[model samples]
Target: MGNRLDRDQVVGTALELLNDVGLEGLTLRRIGKELDVQAPALYWHFKNKQDLLDAMATEMLRRMNALQEREQEAEGGSGTGTWQETLAGSHRTLRRVLLAYRDGAKVYSGTRFTDTSYAIPMERFLAPLVRDGFTPGEAARAFYTVYCFTIGYVIEEQSAADDPGRGVKGIDVAERAERLAEFPLAAAAGAELFGDADAGFEAGVAAIVAGIAATRERGRKVN
Candidate 1:
C-alpha cells in the first residue's frame, strides 16, 4: 500500500469494478481492497462513497466528451452544429457512454461532477442555441430538458436490458393485449412501446428538440 495513490488511479479502478459489482455493491471499502490499499487511504482522495461516485461521474463525462470529440473530428471539425443537431448528438453520445458501464445511470443520476471539464462541451452546446436566440437561461433550460430526458431514458434502458422483468416489461403485455383485444390500439401498443429501443429513444429526442425550437420562435414573438 503506497502512500502516493492518486485520485485518477482510484477512480479508474473503481470504474473497472463497476460493471461487476454495480453502484449499490460498489463500496469504497471494496474499491480499497481491489486497489490493495486501506479504506482510510481512499478518504485522502474522496470523503465518502458519494464523493467517489461524483468523481466516477466526472470520469464518465470525460470519456463521453472524448468520444464526442473523436466523432466530431471524424466528421470534420468540432464546430457546433445547429442547435437541434448539437442537442440530439449530445444525447446520442451520452446514452452510449452511460450504457457502456453497468449501473452507469445510477452512478450518474444526482451526482455532481467533481471537475470543470464539462464546461467545454456545455459551452459548445450552448453557443449555437444562443446564436439562434435562446437567452442563456432559456438555452440552459432547453439543454436540460433534453439532457434529463436522455439520462432518464438510459436509466430505464439499462434497467430493462439488465433485467427484462423490470422496467416497462414488468407489465404483462400479452395478458393486457388479450384483455384489451376489443381495443385495437391498446392491444398493439405494448410491443411498439417496448420494442425498438434505438428508434424509440431517437424519436423522443427528436420530439424534445422540436419543442425547444418552438420555444425559440415563441421568444422571438415575445421580443
Candidate 2:
C-alpha cells in the first residue's frame, strides 16, 4: 500500500529533518514521523540512533565527494592543480557541505563510519599527498590535519553564528575588548582578530598547507 522504506530513504529523511530540527532535536521518532512510517519500520532499518547518525554522516561525506567530482568535471576532469590547491579545495568543499545542514559538523563529529564506501573518498583525499612525495603516514597525517581543522572551524563558526553565547568562552565583543584592555596590542586588534570568520579560516588553511609543503621540501633536501 506504501513505498518500501530503505536505509537510504531513512538517512535522506533524517538529513532533511536534521536541517529543520538540528542534531539535538533529531531522533528516530522524528525521522519516522517525517517519513510517515511507524517506529517499528524505522527500527528495522536502524537499531539505534547512533546507527542512523553514522548513516547520515556517511551520506554527508558522499555528498562532499559528489561535489568534488562535479567541481573536477567542470574543470575539464583533469583536476589539475598543485597539492596545496587540491587539499584546500577538498577542505573548502567539506566546509560547504557541513554548513549546508544545521549542526552538521556536530553530527559528523559524533559519527564513526564503519562502511567500506568511505574508503574511496578517503583515498581520493590522501592519494594526492602521497603522489606529491609524502610518505603514506605523512599523507594520512596531512589529510587528518586539514580534516580536523575544517571540522573544528565549522563547529565554532556555526555555533557562533547560531548561538553567540555558546561559542568559544562566550566572549562577546565588549567582553573581549574589556579583557584585552590591559594589553594594548590585543585590545586594538581584538575586532580584527574576531572580525571575519571566513578570512580567518582561509588564512589558517593556507598557512597549514604552506607549512606542510615547506616541511616536505625541507625533508626532501635533507634526504
Candidate 3:
C-alpha cells in the first residue's frame, strides 16, 4: 500500500474509511491503520480528524463539479440546461453523492472547506442566476436556499434509511393505517402523504426555483 503517501492519498484513504465505518466510527487512528501508516503520519497531511472530514467534503464537491462539467460536455457544450434545470440537476447530483457513503450528509454538514477550489463550482452555479436578473448576493442566497434544503433532506433520508427502526418507531404499516383511520381525510390521502420520495423532492425543488423567479420579477417591477 506504499506509493509515497501524500495529502490526497491520506484524504482518499480517509474517505474510503468513511464509507466503511461511517462518520461516528471514523478516526485518524482508524484511517492510519487502513493506510498502513501510523496515526501521527495522518497529522502530517491533515491537522486532525475534522480537517480530514473537511478534505473529504471538499473531494465530494470536486467530484460533483467534474461530473457537472462532464454532463455539460455530453450535452454538446450547449450547457446543461436552463437555470432551473441546472439547479435541479446539481441538487440531485449532490443528493446522490451524499447518499453513496455512510453518514455522508452528516460529514459534509460539519465541514467548512478552506479550499479555494470550491469557488470554481460556486461561480459556475451562481453565474446563471445572476445573469437571469438576480444580483450576486441574491444569486448566492438562492443557491444557499437550495443547497441547505438538499443537505437537510439527504440527512433525514440517510438517517431513515440507515435505521428504519429509529425512523418509524412503533409505527408499522398496519399501525400507521389504523392511526390514520380515525382521520378521514388522512386515511383517504394514503400513499400520497408518504410515498414517491423522488416526486416530493422534485416538487420542493420546483417550488424553491419558482419562488426565486417570482422574487426576481417583483424586484424588477419595483425598479
TM-score of each: 0.88, 0.86, 0.85
lDDT of 2 by residue, 128-178 (tens): 777777888988888889989999988877775456443432346567878
Model 3 misses residue 55 by how many Å?
A: 0.7
Give per-model CA RMSD. Answer: 2.6, 3.0, 3.2
lDDT of 1 at 79: 68
Residue 213 in candidate 3, Cα distance off native in Å: 1.4
lDDT of 3 by residue, 88-203 (tens): 87798888888777778898896988588889888788777777767899878888899998888777666665554533221244456688788877765544434445675777
**lDDT comparison, 2 vs 3, better candidate:** 2
List where candidate 1 sits over 4 angstroms from the true fold: 1-5, 164-185
Query: How far off is residue 23 in model 2, in Å?
Result: 0.8
Cα RMSD for predicted model 3: 3.2
Better of 1 and 2 by TM-score: 1
Candidates arranged by TM-score, highest first? 1, 2, 3
Ranked candidates (lDDT, high to low): 1, 2, 3
Q: 136, model 1: CA deviation in Å? A: 1.1
